[model samples]
Target: MNSNQQNSDHWLVRPSTIRGLWIGGSILLALTVFLQFFIKIKGYFVVDGWLGFGAVFGFLCCVAMVLVAKGLGRFIKRDDNFYQGGNSDD
Candidate 1:
């Protein structure tokens, strides 16, 4: 195969992968919205508001945590060979 053909193929998303992600995302979104109706945990620190708002707040908090983790991983990652030949006792 030519280099250009290989590169174009690398950039393509498989149909199954796209379908799986779409199905997974829809399920998660449904579960998030559904949980608000059927589940309640007592909180010592309650923000005075509607119950639906609390679920939205929790979802946002989860998203924020994911973003923070991604940022930290990028910031703290080392090159693959960073310590490959280093002397431990130096």
Candidate 2:
């Protein structure tokens, strides 16, 4: 019945875990961008050859997807008790 019941001092909720995750992600992003200089793109798209292009593209795509999902949620979302005819306790 309590919100903290699930967390219960889990490591995932700790500050160290959050900091480590961000650091790891940044390192991976930087490494991939650095490698893009020597890696030639065989694709027809010119922007694909630019450094950090993939990361930017992927990030933009993710943002667009989240925006679209949020927009659609307004029309598709239902009340928590919509399936139970408003009697959620049942």
Candidate 3:
């Protein structure tokens, strides 16, 4: 490695690549939702029949999981030095 030369960055970490990925993912998500208009969806529940319900429900579920995990973390977390010393008694 040359001291004066810059290190090569990964393609996935590049800002342009990240923006392109976001654009592609958004297009795919929109296409799936738009296709629902042409197809007959046999939803098990009434709420599932609403347009964009899947996307909304999925997003809400993810948020709920994050909240639950954060709450649980409070109860389970240990101090930074919890394991620093072999014995609890100094």
TM-score of each: 0.42, 0.70, 0.76
The C-alpha local distance difference test score for the whole of candidate 3 amounts to 0.86
**Worst lDDT window (10 residues) for model 2?**
81-90
Which 10-residue window in model 3 sums to the lowest lDDT? 1-10
Off by over 4 Å in 3: 1-7, 86-90
Better candidate by lDDT, 1 or 2: 2
lDDT of 3 by residue, 1-90 (tens): 453332376778767889999999999889989998998777899889888888889889999999999999999999998878766665
Tens digits of per-residue lDDT for model 1 on 1-90?
Answer: 676765566333755667888899879877866786677745556663345665578779999999999999999999999978777875
Model 3 clash count equals 0
The lowest-lDDT stretch of 10 consecutive residues in candidate 1 is 41-50
Model 1 TM-score is: 0.42
Q: Which order, best to worst by TM-score?
A: 3, 2, 1
Clashes of 2: 0
lDDT of each: 0.74, 0.83, 0.86
Residue 54 lDDT in candidate 3:
89
**lDDT comparison, 1 vs 3, better candidate:** 3
